[model samples]
Target: MPVWQTIYSELSQYNFSVFSIMEDKNIEDARPWIEKSGAKFPCTIDTNHIISDLYNMFNVPTVVWIDENGKIVRPNDVVVMNEGGAKLVKVDPETYIEKIRRWVINNDPPMNSNDDFIKYKQQREHTDNEQVARAEFLIGQWLYNNGELELATQHFETATELSPADVMIQRGTMSMRGMDPMKDYGPIAGNIIKKGLRLYRPIRD
Candidate 1:
């Protein structure tokens, strides 16, 4: 999302922020990107997955639109800032800035027509079930790091049910695919952790 900021929020001159949702799960994995982006914007941690659960977040990159009344005037696919109140079009950076100024001066909401609203709504995917799966997956990651393979397997497998295509969840599921953990971890703990890691594919892999 940040990569497209030049043409999106930055060009349009709107404040942007990120919320990394987890169930009190640690996400040191994102440290490098956070530092490098030099975004300066505060990134929030949603330990309870409260916002994700309520907003039907299934994917990592999802957007939500909230109105001034704190109501979701437009729920999903809130990225269509090219829409000038009703009509959507490709605008130059100058045009985008002008529209933003008009909106601010007019005290008007970013507008979308009924048709545009329908299209946006159709794009919103996922629900609370998927959010729970995310939380469980994070818990499994914690367990795996702490040498609690058996407990981690339980949560990881459950996460696959909610989002079968999710790579991290799939890796955890395949990690124990053919191995007998009790035998492996008991006799060769070091080999088990390493060899078990080999079973689960990384995103980089």
Candidate 2:
């Protein structure tokens, strides 16, 4: 978050602004981190995971490049901006930042607008079950907001089962269900790995 603040400080001159979103059910869960970051950029909490649903994003730290015209030039790309984050995600942040710099300062596109990039974005489109899972997740959120905890939990679990790879639905709802995301995510992550599923798939240029 601090690194992103620095990036925004550097790139805002080029009319580049960072809009950070936390896909947490509770604002309190994301508040302390937001306060700690002291970020000058616009930061918002998405209790319903609306951004994820809109962009077909599955994980945290996803970066989407939007142009001045409000068009998404880059979609759902995993970008870690710090060394620790890079190591954890097994991605090189420097290269990604270089792309961002070129795009922002030089007005160069992030990657070659080729068949591969087109295919990558196409692959990111949500599957039918995943779309159903999103519906279920939203229903869960509605139920939760309406004070139907048990029904909400059931819907959340159903959503997770329908789209286990979607951390937005799985880990994002944990806190609302009285589960520790850090502690509970380990087992779910382990299962995902055992099944040869990737929690974070970095699409490189």
| Candidate 1: segments with Cα more than 4 A from true spot | 1-25, 46-50, 78-111, 114-146, 162-205
Residue pairs in clash, model 1 = none
Taken over the whole model, the C-alpha lDDT of each candidate is 0.48, 0.85
lDDT tens per residue, model 1, 87-193: 42232435434544444446454544656565656754665666678788778767776888888878877886675544334432344444443453333334334
Query: How much is the lDDT of residue 144 in candidate 2?
Result: 92
Cα displacement (Å) at residue 15, model 2: 1.6
Q: Which stretches of candidate 2 lie over 4 Å from their true place?
A: none
Q: How close is candidate 2 to the true structure, as a TM-score?
A: 0.92
- Residue 45's lDDT within candidate 2 is 94
Reference-based lDDT, residue 39, model 2: 100
TM-score of each: 0.48, 0.92
Q: Could you tell me how far off, in angstroms, the CA of residue 109 lies in candidate 2 after the best superposition?
A: 2.4
Q: After superposition, how far is residue 51 of candidate 1 from its true place, in Å?
A: 3.9
Instruction: Give the per-residue Cα lDDT of candidate 2 at 99.
Output: 83
